[model samples]
Target: MANTPAIGYKFDDISEINTSKDAWAVVATPIRLWVVPSFSGKKLPYSMELVLMDAKGGKIHASVRQSLIYKFQPLMNEGRVYQISSFGVEESRGDFRTTGHGYKINFQFSTSVRLVKDLPINRSPYSFMPLSDVALNNPDSYYLIDVMGILTGYSEELEFEKDGKKNKKMTIEIEQDGVRMECAFFGNYVAEVLGQIAAGDKNNAVIVIQLAKIKPFRGKISLQNAYGSTRILFNPDVEGANSLRQRFLEAHEPAAQVLNHLPNSGKISVSDDFLKRHWGKTVEQIKNMRANLKPSQSFSIPLEHNRTIEHNKQNALLATGSWGMRAWILESEVCLRPPW
Candidate 1:
């Protein structure tokens, strides 16, 4: 008998696949994969969502229905190369679409998925939007975006009742190139971000949030998590993060050097003589002084205790300005006994 030749299957580019095709095959990597829950509040699995990227850097959203999740979940892994074929193609529709690709893949019973031992795609799957541009984003925008910045501050986790269920939320402030923006994480994401901060250094930590939605809350624009699709990375070891860290360091190097060279570098003393000179200044005057202050220059004004301002034993206020103008009250005996 003559030797039989194996049949070859052709793969289509992610960008080329559309609803017009019945049989489609593609070699792509699942950059992100997560299970979505039912919107009916039944606490049941709805479907498995994935953001897949081809070797050419084209990305498309893919979904495995709740019933087929068991069959496909085991066969696919994030960041791993796979040969997927015979999947259904449909028009992408969602209030918060993960990708800009007009079409998305729908895994069917006959959908074939197998692991490929080839090297995965090396290109970055992120198209990060600048913090400055965030304000310009339309609140009703359909597509989600990726963003990375330095974690400057965060609020306490708050619990609230919604739909007769308890939900948690936390707001974090991130800054990039002197521009600051707030992002709110809800549900399990509250714990996820806080856990990462606890595990690592939270000060000036580089945080990368992928597939974030731009939302308007209380008449202010903010970034928010898009259910299970949002991925949070803290101090990620990537090119963008390294570059941001480098820029931050370079910008603050002068302030850091100045602090290092100062005698008793960690402590600032407010003498009675210093307090006497600033004691009579009103809060408005102090605000004006701060407004006129130059970089790396600061002025301190003693606040009058009218039983309104909270104070500890020391009661000292220290105002300092560096690369970024920062002011904070310090605990010192000088503040405890103000010179009238």
Candidate 2:
């Protein structure tokens, strides 16, 4: 037997609630929650963002503004079902959208929340978009999406100044079906990825990034974290992750076996034939080759040429280990030397 609320309370479907309705209530579980930073650069958070899913599997984005945080923050809990009423409904317009619902819920001062224990609802509400589909998506689209794939490679943490404060960023490459996509994570997200890499085997690790924004650079598309809305999971114990791991291993077993036999040298070596062909190339020629170079590949340049490249494009040159091994790695920006 399931427990029910009072007879006067009628739960409305998430899809049915709109601004037209005078009173509405919904039984939904908060699947994802994050605190949005204040846009004004203040220390306090601007609002609490959430992705809620109803018993019918309908999802919606909800927000508790800063002013009302004290009142509602204590009552809300992630992964718990709640009966909510008296919330405001408004058009969901933003560069980063957590859900596809036409409208979003806003917690008003008069809003009510009650814990519900008997609702049968799906807890793992993930809608993963394929890597190939992400490449075809419009870069300027406002709707953010979820993605899951095998973690192939990642760049070293890069630090820079943003708004007079030091910030960190790291770029990672994920692959599926021979199609690879570059994803950049900033701030704490970079640490999260690094921590996961340190804790587990990096080879064939499954990664899931939720609500990532599509970005286009040069002629290719990539993914970037959408501020506080993005959620990252590394080798999570979920159905989607398990399925991806099995498929990737089955498809790439032969390739993996071949790679296992290859030398595990920390530095990549270039063939004499490749060096002979590219020797004495101008910096302009190297810039043109950026589009063709893979993230994992690196090429060497003479120490004399380093000064010329640095003088002309200082921002593009990320001085790495040493001048003796002037190996440049290609990413969104070229590095003067290999990270190793």
Candidate models: Cα lDDT each: 0.71, 0.71
Question: What is the total number of backbone clashes in candidate 1?
Answer: 0
* Top-scoring candidate (TM-score): 2
Model 1, residue 261: displacement in angstroms?
Answer: 29
- Tens-digit per-residue lDDT, 273-318, candidate 2: 2233223554466676554556565444453213333322222342
Worst 10 residues of 1 by lDDT: 259-268
What TM-score would candidate 1 get against the native? Answer: 0.70
Model 1: per-residue Cα lDDT at residue 149: 90
Note the clash tally of each candidate: 0, 0
Off by over 4 Å in 2: 1-4, 137-140, 253-340
